[model samples]
Target: MSADKLYILDTNVLLHDPNCLYEFKEQDVAIPMTVLEELDSIKDRKQSVAQEARHVIRAIDNILSAATSPTQITKGVQILVPGTGDDSKLGKLSVFPDHELTSRQGFLPIEKNNDNRIINCALHLQSSDPHRDIILVTKDINMRLKAMGAGLQKVEDYRKDQLVSDVELLPSGHYHIEGNFWEKVSDVKSYQEGPNTYHKVSPDLLPEAYVNQYVFDDSNDFAARVESIDHEKTVLRDLGFGHLMQQSCWGISPINIYQAFAMQSVLDEDIDLCVLNGAAGSGKTLVALACALEMVIEEGRYNKIIVTRSTPPVAEDIGFLPGTEEEKMTPWLSSIHDNLEAMHENDDRPQSSVKYAIEKANIQFKSLNFIRGRSIQDAVVLIDEAQNLTPQQLKTILTRCGKGSKMICLGNLAQIDSNYLTPLTSGLTYIVERFKGFDGAANIHFEGIFRSRLAEYAEEHL
Candidate 1:
């Protein structure tokens, strides 16, 4: 095993992942005094960041109490997992006080700012231990740049929560086969149900397929759907959704196979969680909303539809917003109203029939602030703009689902508005990779733009 390395953690890294303390196996971690002060400033807020701050503080306190006395925290205290019995890799955690840095020679100016103090701490540690490797781990780009400018060689981002390094390499949940696809599958055990045919094949003999994933063969115009997979068998179902895709749902029809797969996922009762990722003008929102209404209003599947999003500002400040909760959220939810209005353009009732249906169907628009500590049941929960959510926030939202409920998360990973989040570590990509082969979960990536030719051209050209 390699020798343990010293890692100086930034405040943002801890807030990004509360369990980051134990993630560095067999390595020493140091927390700057300024970081604790920063945590104290925001730990009382009512958002996810505040919650994470509290979690980190609790973890640090527990570690200190379990180890040597509290007065010895500065000298260095060994941190061990409570019950893991793995002491060979147990690392030390310590807080570098301001006096330690200020007493050192050639130390940078310890300004009142937190970022500069943190950098100075790292610099002091590097100068003290010339034989050991000390790296500064942070999520802030500007902090990294400043550290590099201060002669720190080993600076990096916390990569524990990132699932995919490249967005293009993410799984598409669909595969295409050529040259006699049906003939290749005829030798497998097969049966037919009400509307779909089922086949069981071996995972080693065929391409990898997840439950509810789409498979198309353009050579013979054949498409298959994955039903289930187990150790002994891989169950496949025929694509019986072609005719259903042609049917109108709330005045919207499938424009492409991407939309068709999305519709099949949302309308299927067997799939409880559906995740959709795509760019603007790909009909992601419109398709999900259409199927949601059909299930809630027409088929009597779900009793209500609850809509919520990250509430990240697009081009305006949220501080100046005025009115009731619903009124403040109306602008953020304008796409929902616009899609509903377009669906009801040919209605014979008044122009406000969309509003009437929303009230009659028991659809409610909610803000993401209060999603915690509530159990949602018998409803279709829609989380739009999921790319702006952190992984911790996403976990809290998904845990709110109760019995007889479905959740649909839609987002464009390329348009993340969160300052501390990236495309690789956003909630949308995290859920997509985590739930790939899990039962009752399915994900689809839409690349087709059905809004208009100009929009499609812009998507491709601009």
Candidate 2:
């Protein structure tokens, strides 16, 4: 049997998603020896990426276990898809011994760099099999440019986990109407359910409506949340603009309607997951913290508040810091403290008020490295800087939420810090699009930056 295409895997791609092997349906995948060496070096590190490295190593071993000898491993091993019994749909996996490649006229010098070695392997495969399509798949942009510049035919980024093609096309969680919302509706049914008002209208009125998505009109008269949508009709729960603007939590009120939408979701007990996406200084962290404090301290709905975020790779080895876990995490979590201080800045004694609030709310700062295989119950989990996380990393943290818990993910897509992630591939964007239609999840994208005039100007011009 002849394969149409052959894809060479990169170390970063497997680290980005361990299960990416199954993403290619029928296309054969090859792993260079250099990639395995890179994973071996990273598997012993203390960072969260080390866990992913180990996972990829185990997955590759499991697939190649069926091979009998070194020759068979180099030739190809049939990959069996879990839960599928079809033999025709299997893709072959093989290991390319790139270290044994001799110095050739066209091959890049592989003295010490693993990237050059991987590129040379792809080039050798391309030359050996002229009929098959050879593609180099990686998450590194500079590597792609380098591979293409070194005379490789096709180089592509691994886009299997990218939900949207462009970040600008992501859902904003709210629909805006130019004129009056009621004027566009020809037929509608209005009623009162207990203290809440409901409106049932044609689904055509809001073509892109989703559950829990806010809707407003320019007339400043109508504001509602999409309660339900079906082929027959769409139901909306009327939320008055005046009432939304008047809502406050922990002595903090929203400065705009966008922020009010976010506060509404973070404060709602029915919403199990609330995702806030916006520019920096859009009050994502401040609003979530205020609502979390209100729930834990004022209402006593939750037992405590847990705050965590993915640290940059350079700062992942935080074990050397002196003090307890919370103390070690304080520098990384200073933004949380800043927001707490901002909330209490008006008090006679600001530092004392902040301390009292922290104790009263029972807030705990946690590290993402220690949040695995443990169930967190009766707490509010707030994940800040969510844009720096991959989808797999985000899933690990989200699954830690146990009984009687709510999770709030705050991210700014424009401020992603991960080398392997783009705005489209950030976990923040992934969850926003994936949870838009869920009944228990709400998403809000803040457009205004209320931190200061400098931040607002920097967001626009700089």
Candidate 3:
């Protein structure tokens, strides 16, 4: 098929996402010979990567090997399908002075992936034919920036799936609720009408977050349902949770420290909402469920605990995903099961009783689409993988909170699944940004991955 765009594949781009080959579609794209060479080196390995590395190299090799002549071989920056080639000659690769491509960032002695050859190739291509556009496709943000800074045209994230920059994304949150005050709000006059919980603000933080749809009683400090101001009981720094308030199920689980504790929040009378945001394996969902179970079995706070993830397979992407939504979500939601297993492990209840609790625990594995019409009052709603929810979608889910209900949105911002900034503009930010001023409202940011040293290291380095 013929196409308009010209794409030059970088080594990292292919390795980062193996499907990189088809992403260019009908566009004129060519994997750099050097990139192919790089893939060859990884063909024989024990790791999972060896299979992919070998597959990509073998596929390309077959396509190139059968060509009868150079004229029929893959040429031009424009992509040719596996067996197709363009007769139009683009001439041998143009050569440019080495200085045109080198970066001072290179002089710093970083290892190979951040090397110079990739950058040089793009500069040479661009400088040689000013009219012929050469796009350097890479996953490295720094490399792209360095390429641009060096005067060559460059682009980061060549995953053809990327949406427009203006596309709505999940909004990253800000920590604005950093003060100490306690009080209650009575009339709640339109204050706590929804089943969703609302944050009651301390006298100190009056009228901070009433942007729109936010009901605020600015004149009063000691209202109902909101916390009552306390003067006698001090900060209680001795509780040992100095980095956060209240204990977390995973990180910095100090019962006392009240600095930057993170948890999902919902309604108090109906079902208390405690949100947890931590890196993968940080026990955010596990902890949220533990709390939910506590309320269901012990506190009698709510009828059931419902857990959901804001993700389902998109159409084109689901081809590789086996089975139905249940099967697909099974792998992704393994974390949910793992946590539930942990919750029920060693319990005295019978298998049926435990299964009943788990089933009756009111845990509903749901997609973001169904949350619109349901008024979830008197229920603990835990939304996992919330980063996948866009801002508008998240707003819709949050607004569906019914009377005496709690909703918890949890996700790691850095590990977003959606093509858009589904980690930022989503409802998580909507709630965090909208509810900081209320005294009854509390939030925490759990630091340090509790899974393992390697998991934490992976998050930091990779």
Write model 3 residue lDDT over 146-242, tens digit each, in one string.
7788677656565443333332332122222233223342322223333433443333343322211111122222111223334321111111122
lDDT of 2 by residue, 24-97 (tens): 88889999999999999999988889999999999899889989999988988887885674547768889999
For each candidate, the alpha-carbon lDDT, in order, equals: 0.81, 0.91, 0.51
Collision count of model 1: 0
Off by over 4 Å in 2: 83-87
Q: Give per-model TM-scores.
A: 0.92, 0.98, 0.45
TM-score of 1: 0.92
- Provide the lowest-lDDT 10-residue window in model 2: 81-90
Clashing pairs in 1: none
Residue pairs clashing in model 2 are none
RMSD to truth, every model: 2.8, 1.3, 13.7
The better candidate by TM-score, 2 or 3, is 2
Error of 3 at 111 (Å): 40
- Misplaced by over 4 Å in model 1 are 1-3, 67-71, 82-89, 99-105, 202-205, 219-221, 230-233, 313-320, 348-350
